[model samples]
Target: MESTSPMRLSFEIRQMSPQQKLPSPDVGGMSRSARVMALLGLQYTRPFHRDALFLFFFALGPAVWLSMTVLFALQPSPRHALWSPVFLSVALWQPLCEELLFRGLIQGHLLESMPKQKTWLGLSISNLLTSCLFSLAHLANHSVSWSLLVFLPSLCFGFMRDRFGSVYPSILLHVFYNGGYFLLIGSATR
Candidate 1:
């Protein structure tokens, strides 16, 4: 008796061949920065995205320091008086720019070039280098002590970016962390 199932008794096969060339996606329409950011967004995983976000807060650190210095210089009579608006600006703008540059651009590129296991090392080195650059960028502000404190958090942000594979959370954590510092120190200073 013959089976009536859809199984075939004989099969035909064809030779496999690889394509000589692969087509590249069209990106000519996108602006350089836009294209780069889009690539970063895609390449980074959820955790890294979070980390990028956290790193964003570090951007505010220098700004906060500068604003405070300016206010203090202008009116040493009431140190705490300028906290209101500065605090809000730090909470808002710092994270946005920091994430854009550090986690989104810098770490994103590092992760692309290095192997997964080495991501931590890459992130650490990159974070240190960039953080130093970041700190130095504020040379005009000229507070070694503040820069040192900022460095610590920047390292934490780098670790966060490596562990999570995203910058979003990093920016959030950054904003909160720096904001807390601002509130605490500003309140105490006042």
Candidate 2:
């Protein structure tokens, strides 16, 4: 009276919608290591396009530097030292690594379970949570105030990651922000 063949079961699974086929990785269905690998392997490249959001972030870099100058008495340091290893690390290395870890892995993993709805000023809950962790990570090498300031930019990076479905844009923005921030604010690392 009932069909229990493997073919029938496979057909039934095929009939289900994508959303119904399996649980999200963060929904306790996947092992921790498997989830980490899946998230890390998520799309890291998207066709480059200067969309409005990208333009907004690009312009915000200068504005941020100016605000730091006026608000925190941050002096613009000499650009002659721009070729130093520390400058290279902040501008290039750190952005790539941070974006890969935070946006590519952590936020991507969170998005699997969290609703995509914009909860805070167009940011998803995943972005907010990732930003908090990002800021906390900065506290190891930065002052409390400096670390807190990292939260906003972390949100921006996460937003770009979600919007583009890739980590490339986030990395670019991170580099732009860090290079300018260190150049203007003198890398106030503790």
Candidate 3:
């Protein structure tokens, strides 16, 4: 004998268990656009803190260069005050932009789909690619020497980003590296 009532059928169906809970996706595994937005948000929220490292890098860079210049005054080269403006604008500005693009945005997105080991490998590959692009971006400078210098340092920046888990250190390191290079060049030229 079977019950044919509509209410009885509804009751039977209700007896089934609810579905199991699935694991939540990691928040860090956001899309590139989302990560960019997040980075921008971070910058906006803590503009001072974010910019502090850069400012420190900027100030310290010149000082370090001056010291090295004084110490290595024996090296003869073309002295040019014009390079000061170029160093601040090009070297500092470019590295900051590149860090935001590569480490903050692109790396954040790629890390989403990757396992731990794969994430490291992906980061390495992405860093290399990004660094190459960065180096190539200097094509207008039109010097193989400049390109070669940029390539290795850009890789070092990527490596720093990977190790520190934040682009801030790398940004600082980059500014230092560039600043040091300019200071050395400027001192040598003098």
Clashing residue pairs in candidate 2 (N, C-alpha, C atoms within 3 angstroms):
none
**Whole-model Cα lDDT per candidate?**
0.52, 0.70, 0.51
lDDT of 3 by residue, 120-148 (tens): 22234446666777778777654665565
Q: Which ten residues in a row have the lowest lDDT in candidate 1?
A: 16-25
lDDT of 2 by residue, 1-190 (tens): 2221121113121233333221233426877776675565344334534576677888888887776565466756577769788889888999989998998788877877654333455566678899999999988887787777778788888877766667778888899998998888775541
TM-score of each: 0.52, 0.71, 0.51
Shift in Å, residue 163, candidate 2: 0.5
Candidate 3: count of backbone clashes, pairs at least 3 residues apart or interchain: 1
Badly placed stretches (over 4 Å) of model 2 are 1-38, 41-48, 70-73, 115-118, 187-190
Which should have the higher TM-score, number 1 or number 2?
2
Q: Which is the better candidate, 1 or 2, if ranked by lDDT?
A: 2
